[model samples]
Each structure stands twice: as C-alpha cells, then as structure tokens.
Target chain A: MAGYLNLLLRLTIWFLLTADLSWDNLLLGVTIAVLLPRGATNPGTLKDWLYTLGEVVAAIPQAYKEAFEIMIYPHHHEAITLERAKPRRTPSLLFLDIFLITFTPKTIVQHYCEQGWYEVHRIQRRPTP
Target chain B: MINILSDGCMIIGLVFWFWGTWPLLGQRSVLYKLHSLSVADTLGSMAIVMGLLLRIPHEWPLLLLALISLAIWNTVLGYVLAYCSTREIGHDG
Candidate 1:
C-alpha cells in the first residue's frame, strides 16, 4: 500500500518536472516510478494515511486564521507547554503532528521526548474588539 | 474577473509578507519570529505562486510544483530550526 502511494508521489513529481503527457513520456515515467527503490518501510495503514491527509487539509484554513490572528498586536501570552503524545504513535504520524502544530503561527513543537511529551512553545493572543 | 482574482491574490500575498516581516524588528523571541517568517515565507509565497499560476496558466506544472515545495520545505525548515536552537539552549535554561 505504501509502495503504491510512494509510486504515485514519485510519478507526480516526474510529471510535474517533464510537464508533458505524451504516451512515451507516460511510459517512461511509469517505468521510472516502478523501478526506483522504495524508501525504508514506513508502517502506515491506508486508513491512517487518509486520516492524516484529511487532518492536513483541515489544518490549512486553521493555519491561515492563526497567521492573521498572530499579526494582531496586543497583549499576548507566551509559554512553554508540555503536550503528551500517544505513546505508540508512529514516526510518520509524529512528523505530521509536529508539522501541523508548527505550521500554525500560534504553536511550535520544540522537541519530542522519549517520554512521549512534546515541548511546545505557544503564543496565546487575545482577540481584539 | 480572472484578472481581478489574480491581482487580489498577489495583493493578499504581499500583505502577508509585509505583516509577517514587520515583527522581526520588535522584541519578540526567536520562536515567535520564526512563526511569523513561516507564515510570510511559506504561505505568502504559496499565495504568490498561485497568483502567478492564474496569470500564466500555461506554466502551471512548474508553478504548482514550486508552490508545494515552498509550503512543505518552509514548514519543515522552520520546525527543524526551532527544534535545534531550543535544544541547544537547554530547554528552559
């Protein structure tokens, strides 16, 4: 499953680079995509993949909102907070979680501890009237 | 109509860039500055790239790829920098 996903991702990059849809180009792309060695086996289910993708899509609007809110100059509170992670969370999920949090302007994940805690730096901005 | 939308995108992106960059001169911490930079550099660049895509639909493949790269790389780079810097600072030290 992950192999097919990796293939699709590689193919997208190939198509974007070549920017052509000729039959020969398509054949060549498919050949290259298939022939390329896969990365280290990453444990992920299709369901998990779709869920992560959905979460990412949802975070886009939230990120924009946070970006605008952070621009507001007001009395904001900054703090270092510890967020607990799921003990069994996989590396890919951890990556996505860190990305999503940091992508928003309000919070950043500074480090992930072996104890399953995320040290987060967060800015709490008050809404202006 | 399309022209207006493309122009609007460019303008919005410019606004983001300005606002995001404006905070660097203040007394904000390094993390806060990084957050702002990501918003400006990543999201703002994506918006500008999209505006260009609307303007030059023929070169969409390249622009789209650039948009994706900007978004992902900027986000990751910001995280990595923050993670590394804060680590060396000894957390709350």
Candidate 2:
C-alpha cells in the first residue's frame, strides 16, 4: 500500500511534468514511476501516510493564518524548545512532521537529535517589556 | 468576477511577498527569518500561481507543477537552510 501510494505520487508528478495526456505518455509515465528507486522508508502503515497527507493539506490555511498573525502583530518573543516525537514514528512520518512544523510561520525544527527530540525554535506574541 | 478574483489573489500575494521579505533587513536570527520566509513566501507564490491558474486555466499542468514544487520544495529548503546555518554555529561555538 505504501508502495502504491509512492507510485501514485510519482505518476502524478510525471504527468504534470510531461503536461501531456496522450496514451503513450500515460504508458511511459507508469513505467517510469514504477521503475524509480524507492527510498529507505521505515516501516509505516498506509493509514499513517494518508493522515500525514491530510495534515499537510490542512496546514495550508493554518500557514496563511499564521502568516497574517505574524504580519499584524508586534515583535514576538522567540524560543527554542525540545519537542518529543510520537512513539514508533517512521522516518518518513517524522520528516513530514518536521515539514508541518516548519511550514507554519511561528515554529521550525532546528535539529533532529539522535535522542529523538526535535530542537524547535518558535515565536509567540508577548507583551513588550 | 474571475478577473477581479485573480487580480485580488495576485495583490494578496504581493503583500505576502513584502511581508515575508521585509524582515531580511532587520536584526534577527536566521531561523527566525526563515520561519517568515518559508511560510509567507511559499504561500505568496502559491497565491500568485493560483491567480495565474485562474486567469489561464489552459496552462494548468505547468502551473500545477509549479504550485506543488513551490509548496513542497520551499518548505524543505527552509529546513535545509536552517540545518546548514545551525550546524555552522554548532561547529564554531
């Protein structure tokens, strides 16, 4: 299931890259999408992948809201915090989580520690001293 | 209606560009700047592309590709940039 999801993603990219809907294009795209080397993804279920995808989509509006909040507000207090990862999260999902965190305006995962904590830097609106 | 909407999107996108980029001139940490840049810039570019997509729906394949790459790559690029700069700091200090 994960493999099929990867293929679908690749094929979609292929189609958009080719910008053609011809029968021959379809065949070649499928072939290439299938033949591409797979990355070393830790064992993760398809459900997890889909949930991550859903979160990615959901973050778009959230990103915009954060952007606006940052723009409208006064100076913010920045902080660095160590965040714990979900138990047994695959590397792929971990990467996605980092992406989700960093995609927003207020937080970024500065470093991923071998001890499994994310070194996060964040900004929050606080009253000026 | 479409014309107005597309123009509005582009306008909003331009605002985002300036909002995101204005911080580069300020005294701030790299990661802090990166946060604004990735979020606002990516969303801004996507908004402009969306405007274009609405204007010329025929060129959608290319524009769609542009949107996807902008969304995914820019966010990842922020991480990469942050990773590199922070590593340099760790090495020195």
Please report the candidate that would top DockQ against the real structure: 1
Query: Candidate 1 residues B10-58, lDDT tens each?
Result: 9888999998898899998888788778778987887888888999999
Off by over 4 Å in 2: A127-129
Q: Ten consecutive residues with minimal summed lDDT in candidate 2 chain A?
A: A120-129
Q: Can you give the lDDT of residue A63 in candidate 1?
A: 86
Model 1 docking category: medium
Off by over 4 Å in 1: A73-75, A126-129
Candidate 2 DockQ, CA atoms: 0.78
Q: After superposition, how far is residue B84 of candidate 2 from its true place, in Å?
A: 1.6
User: What is candidate 1's lDDT per residue for A1-129, written digit by digit as tens?
Assistant: 766777888999999989999999999999999898875867678877788779888988898877777676542677788999865667777888888888777788888888899898877764333
Backbone clashes, candidate 2: 0
**DockQ for all models:** 0.79, 0.78
